[model samples]
Target chain A: MTFSDIPKFKLKEYSKAPELSSKTIAHKPVIIVGSGPVGLAAALDLAQKGHEVTILTAFDFIALGSKAICFAKQSLDIFDRLGIGERIIEKGVIWNIGKLFWKDQTNPVFQFDMLPVTNQKNPGFVNIQQYYVEDYLVDALEDMDNVDIRWGHSISDIEVRNDGARLDVDTRDGSYQIDADYVLACDGFRSKIRDSMGLDFEGRIFEDNFLIADIKFKGKAAEQRPSERWFWFDPPFCPGGTALLHKQPDDVWRLDFQLGWDIDREAVLKPENVEPYVKGMLGDDIEFEREWYSVYTFQCRRMNRFVHGPVIFVGDSAHLVSPFGARGANGGLSDAENIAWKLDLVMRGIAPRSLIESYNDERIMGADENIRNSSRSTDFMSPKNEQSLAFRNAVLELSNDYSFARPFINSGRLSTPTPYHDSPLSTVDNDEWDGGPKPGFPCVDAPVNDNEDSNWLLEKLGNDFKLLQFGGKAPESDLDVINIPIDSLAAQRYDAHHGATYLIRPDQVVAARWKEAQADDINGAYQRAIGAA
Target chain B: MDKFNDTVNISGHDDIYQMIVDLHADGNEEKSQKINAKLIIAMINQIGSEQIVKEIIEMVRLNEEKYNPRSSTH
Candidate 1:
């Protein structure tokens, strides 16, 4: 809803709460709350599965941070599966090569090769603005016959029932009631639907705020091209300031301003104030210009429960991570990836409602990992405590020496995908090297046959629960034989884990790492996930 | 509902990584837990991140011998 709707959802009387009331049940098959990345994904995903889907959003797409860059390879595979990968790839910038400028005196260093040859289809993450990705998703959803995005619409109430949920959505047009078998809340942090349903969204909030300024690069580029992302640790302009310079479009750099506590947002964002920083870092080459600027605080908070009744939170609604690990949007997109398929299966009656529980469980693990990594990175980059700041400075100072310092610097101070060691769905043993893709499958090359596209394995099993069976012969015809490669990399990767077979779920976590395929056991594994005998 | 976990995500994992492994090995979360954490720490330690290690240690107060994540890489 609007800011005026309620400061933070406080009710003196229990019965008066809209979420607790009976008036909140759904008549429709599924109603999605909030049309950010997660909402859009769920809507598109469910609609594709032959279910009617509607999205409610307080703001339309434009105000959306159009330039939120950084899409991981995993997210790319998800995008490709949604059939929007081609369009996204066409529109987004591939940030395969990245350079780090410590200071003018030091040589520019590179950390990651944008498109490393990972087993996945896409290289690394693509640097498309978040707004562009949203536009693409909105366009894709609009075309879908079953999906409808109601912009300028606000969800006023949420009431869960036995069979489904009921939502009273107040749009700019008018309010209407829609009943759905399930409700998806991708409403984002400060989630209204989540609060109404009475769920816990907990975690730490960092006091230091971040000022993000998106400005066009009028200055000439050095030897390094825009294909790579640049981070300046220290330069005359912004000493002790870490600025992430990402290329938006031709010569347009999206600069993230790590503002100090006392810095005035207005003064810093001004073209004049911004010019000095630009000149100091990039050098006085040409004209100074800017496209957009905004400032927001970074916090690492996660919802205690993802599901309450029929309403489930996704994306920002589910968690908010510091931008350090590039997990903010990427993690949200992954939430969409994890939830969409299961919701689709449930809608199609392929799986039971209980199977939907996996979404909250699996995704929460992912969010926790993301938050943990990003939090670490934020602390190192912008330490609030005095001693911690000194420690961080020491690390940076030591980084100048290529030999000893490189190791610490190389181990990216922040950003890591956490491992899920214990989950009901996982079958990985934290054991030593037996081979094949282990439980937490790291990106390894999966070979394809002649004439077949190199990305066959990745494309085939982008976001579903993929079963990579090197299974010599089919145990039975019932098993969904998702084209396992022969002598190819995928086969080899799984050769040790399961001689003839391996089960990989949508999120790329190993469902079952077996040495051979047992017809009875194999079928049972799928049954457990699907809740079918 | 006690804001079960508001302002933060509490939904995203559902794997009985422990369960399945335990079922495979006859119900042992301790051994299962230790090795898994070690393996993750091993791989992650190799990948390197002073910050990640510090935060991870803070999150899970495992009273095991200290394995400086940086030392593993070095």
Candidate 2:
């Protein structure tokens, strides 16, 4: 796309911290590279734990148009403790429904409403622009006395040895060397930290490029729906065409369209043609004020190892997904929350450094799941060849008629978090108790939680290591767990499919699933996850 | 939600995937006109070129009535 002809639009800017009070730099333990979601979340989590934390960002925090929106329930919960979720929720849109369009037909085919409610409070997700989430996190972190943010600074070089990590950081003004006891590489896909360490990023590069445009409605929207998400499948405006219509918290709409790999970038980006792309997707009758438009390639690459020595990668630095499943940022934030708590434990000497291993164990599974789901979604949207398209069409054709088969048709390949069935760090305890929600988690709104003030249960549980169990005495052990005692009636209804109690790590993946609670069970699971047992 | 397991089930597939990517400015003091232009172009280009021109036309043509098209887009 040509850089010129970029239209004027409202830019949500974040202010940078002018200076950090001088401190004994050598005493800091954790240093995070990249102020992206991953770095920010990790820093916030670490800083909150009373660890000496510092972050180096290449650009001014507010200047970067962080390409993310909305935190999944798992992420929102983390923000709650950081005291930022409230402001974010206020500024963002809460959308539980997504509508799709096929040839001459409008359908809300794949609604997340079908996904079991997230613990009777949060549904599957929430929608807010990434910038707002970052702004909130950065703003909150700014006030903290323990956290130091170095803006306009980049990691020029990294040295990993027995003595923690030595980093040569550069700024537009000058360069300096910073040392830390541990490093969290929250940098993005093109992570300098990951690269300097000589790690391999393995995955398929999606040959397609995706374009995103944020616009404002000029009039009544032709298909104004509360779903918060809309996709188009069949002809008229954009058939087999991929576009995302999302509502921002500020009443602005975010439109994402895949412009194909072969389009002439310069011509398509011209002021004249840019409007047509908008007109075509929204309909001839609708008009929009362009806010911002940019193009990106669809890459599904992830680093082979998320953790390297004292330096661990979080967020996009660990994995990069085509934004299809809305997994990239949310997934990254989840990484932060997961590692944050664990690292806090390890640093405070409550848990061993091996606890950091679970960070990889959990997020890689998350990465794999998000990648597969996103890849599936992106594949459906772009459909590599004619055969895939035909298969998709057949699914769509049978979608309306075949109630059982509709998901394959209506869901334009969306990515969701994945569960780990085999984890070396997590145990699979086989005790015989009535089943309920397994630990690694997709929160369900059981009928029992209705009417009660269940919002707190949903908000805080998964943000940390949550231990959920059905009736009977809570598993007595040393694991840091919040007991989610459930009644048998609700357990039976959900348990016909539910297994035993689950041990969920900070990232909200089942660290262990048990049928019944065995003696010393909680400690066993904890020992297995963090080398305590 | 399409049940992949007991809890987390991601629904809807046959349609085009629509993932919304947000662009934010944290809290900037300087009005970086160049930053805006660069970001606008970079973001579009970052996820650019899905080759959906024909598909977009078909969507408007077939679902013109069903989709509540934004007037400003047209």
Cα lDDT listed for each candidate: 0.64, 0.65
- Kindly provide the TM-score of model 1 when superposed on the true structure, using C-alpha atoms: 0.78
B1-74 in candidate 2: lDDT tens per residue? 21112243456633314221112244342223333433433433333433443444455576875676557765
Worst 10 residues of 1 chain B by lDDT: B1-10
Candidate 1 CAPRI grade: incorrect
Candidate 2 residue-wise lDDT, A1-533, digit = tens? 11133221223232333322234345358888886667887888777767778888776535323267656665666676677877877776776666666666665454554244444444456777666667777887878999888766777889987879988766555556777888988888888887787786788888776567777674457345464677767545554566677777655677777677777766765656767767876677776776666777868889888888898888888888877667888788778877888888788787788878877887898898888787787777677765566556655654555454455553444434455556666675565535444545544434444345543444545545666665454566654544444543445544623434567665555666666666577667766766565
Docking quality of model 2: it rates as incorrect
User: Native-vs-model 2 lDDT?
Assistant: 0.65
Worst 10 residues of 2 chain A by lDDT: A1-10
What TM-score would each prediction reach against the true structure?
0.78, 0.77
- List-wise, what DockQ does each model earn? 0.02, 0.01
Chain A accuracy as TM-score for every candidate? 0.87, 0.86
- Specify the highest-lDDT model's number: 2
First chain TM-score, candidate 2: 0.86
Q: Ignoring the other chain, what TM-score does chain B have in each prediction?
A: 0.34, 0.25
